[model samples]
Target: MSTFDTDLLIVGGGPGGLATALHARRLGLSVIVAEPREGPIDKACGEGLMPGGLAELTSLGVDPAGMPFHGIAYLDERRRAEARFRGGPGRGVRRTTLHAAMAARAKEQDTEWIRTRVNTVEQDAHGVTAAGVRAKWLVGADGLHSSVRRAVGIDVTAGTPRRYGVRRHFKVPAWSEFVEVYWSRWGEAYVTPVEPDLVGVAILSRGQPDLAWFPRLSRQLAGGERGPARGCGPLRQVVSRRVAGRVLLVGDAAGYEDALTGEGISLAVKQAGAAVTAIVEGAPESYEAAWHRVTRNYRLLTRGLVLASTPRPARRAIVPAGRLLPSAFRFGVNILAS
Candidate 1:
């Protein structure tokens, strides 16, 4: 077999990996992205973008004007409180559109896209090796159970898997301007507007996901009408791991916590930027320190949210607190997350 060469070889083509490649290419770095699939598409997500995420898009030179999905809508199902992002400006595009944009942008920057699944990764003091290929640096942007993470002997100590997540699309009238989070003792469901009259509803659970619980919420958002049902396997738990050598991991590959905050993609993209900056400026040590600084508060906040969802007498107080103290609660949440 012949060996392949590259300055940086990314094994996963998801947002984290793709974002890294895009930024690195802009920085005049030789980059190659190995994505098994040729088409660009969004991964499984609730589909909400915050201001910070939009800022990243701007830094990447992407324009949201043409994409499908605009605005944000939030609903407090239990508390009956809601907000809309349409007031200012956000986005509510389908996963595919977002993915296509990222893929196109990466290509525009001259990133060499590869269609191949990695067989294995062998590394040493120099760099990482995969399929007889060698790269100066390897990134594990793959998902929760990343192939790169496994190949590096980096095992994730997981918390119990929470609820089963289900989602579906509906051709409904325009909803609010914020990503709505319906809070109930059962769990939290999010309704996001992707187009002029299209929305995606995602139901997430803490203990065991109950598909039936979210359908009503979905119906309520779709103009008091139900839409097609969509579902995914049991929700993932809090996964945190960092095995430092020649290779590094980011996105869900590094750690995957509850998706309740709708911060996964944004956090992943931001972390990818951080990882690249660290690698270029400070090498491995800087990258490690930056990663810790980035995810430190996020981990604590997510764990606290999980507790709020936990069904116990003492923890049950979250329901009342969230209901009676909306402003106060949001203030604390904002502080903790920031």
Candidate 2:
């Protein structure tokens, strides 16, 4: 009889979960993934993969087709500042497309799948059994409200300001080669071109999503074929720990600060690799330190920016500050992109 059903059992089938499956397969581990949803998963996201993130996904042999953007553009009524990445370009891929590509890659790697929700998680010193599968290890790649995180007693209460994000797609021709962020008194709007004739707009704020809050961006997106809007929120998530016995938390399930810097996918993929490495080496505890190292910059910089953006005077100065200090802005963008 097999000691365990598989080497790794992954909960949730989002991009992060699928990425974990691919990495585990690459390390010669038998894997099974459980996801409640069918078909490609979609979420309310900015959908722009930074250059480094695109490269990471490609290295894993999971590249999705989308529009290309050179860098980032910060725009406001008073000023506009743009910065191109030093090396390659970021791609504005739709969430569904990205998820499909990741799932296909996981399937190609011979990963098993279970189309069911993981309502309970049980683990001991040797292995974990979740969603009815017993494995040497369990990875929670679930989203912000991960059941596994809660079940394992690692979930933490978010201490930062609560904010939400709502996104919609518009049918419009590509006008620029940059991911543009338009600022207003209310919140920030991210415009990314996912297809030649499709642009995704996501607004982040504390208040309810009302495009009317941003007059300029609303006017720009006026009268277009609007796709169904999706919302996700209270962007910040804290965690007491990442590893509990044989179970490890990855991606948003591990913890999250905010989406302001757009590093979620990249960080998730990177954390997936680290989580699998620790599992393969028989040192699940090491993943906690690795997670901190990987997310240090994201946590600090994103928190600082979010704080700076809260005050009206400071928010108004954001664009002009970037414009006046191009080098500093470029450095910031490069750090986040990297």
Q: What is the C-alpha lDDT of each candidate?
A: 0.67, 0.90
- In the range 156-215, model 1's lDDT, one tens digit per residue, is 765664555666766776556566766655777777777776777777765554535555
RMSD of each: 3.7, 1.1
For model 2, the local distance difference test gives 0.90
Backbone clash pairs in model 2 (N, Cα, C under 3 Å; residues 3+ apart or in different chains), count: 0
lDDT by residue for model 2 over 1-338, one digit each (tens)?
44799999999899889889988898899999999899999999999999888888998999899999998999987588999899789999999999999999999999999988886898777878887788989998889999998888885887568999999999978778999999988899999999998999999999887777667777777778999999997888888899999999999899889889887998999999999999999999999999999999889999999998898999999999999999999999999888
Positional deviation of residue 33's Cα in model 1 after best superposition, in angstroms: 0.8
Highest TM-score model number: 2
Reference-based lDDT, residue 106, model 1: 86
Best by lDDT, which number? Answer: 2
Candidate 2 wrong stretches, greater than 4 Å = none
What ranges in model 1 sit over 4 Å off?
1-4, 65-78, 82-88, 206-240, 312-320, 332-338
Worst 10 residues of 1 by lDDT: 65-74
Q: What is the TM-score of each predicted model, taking all chains together?
A: 0.85, 0.98
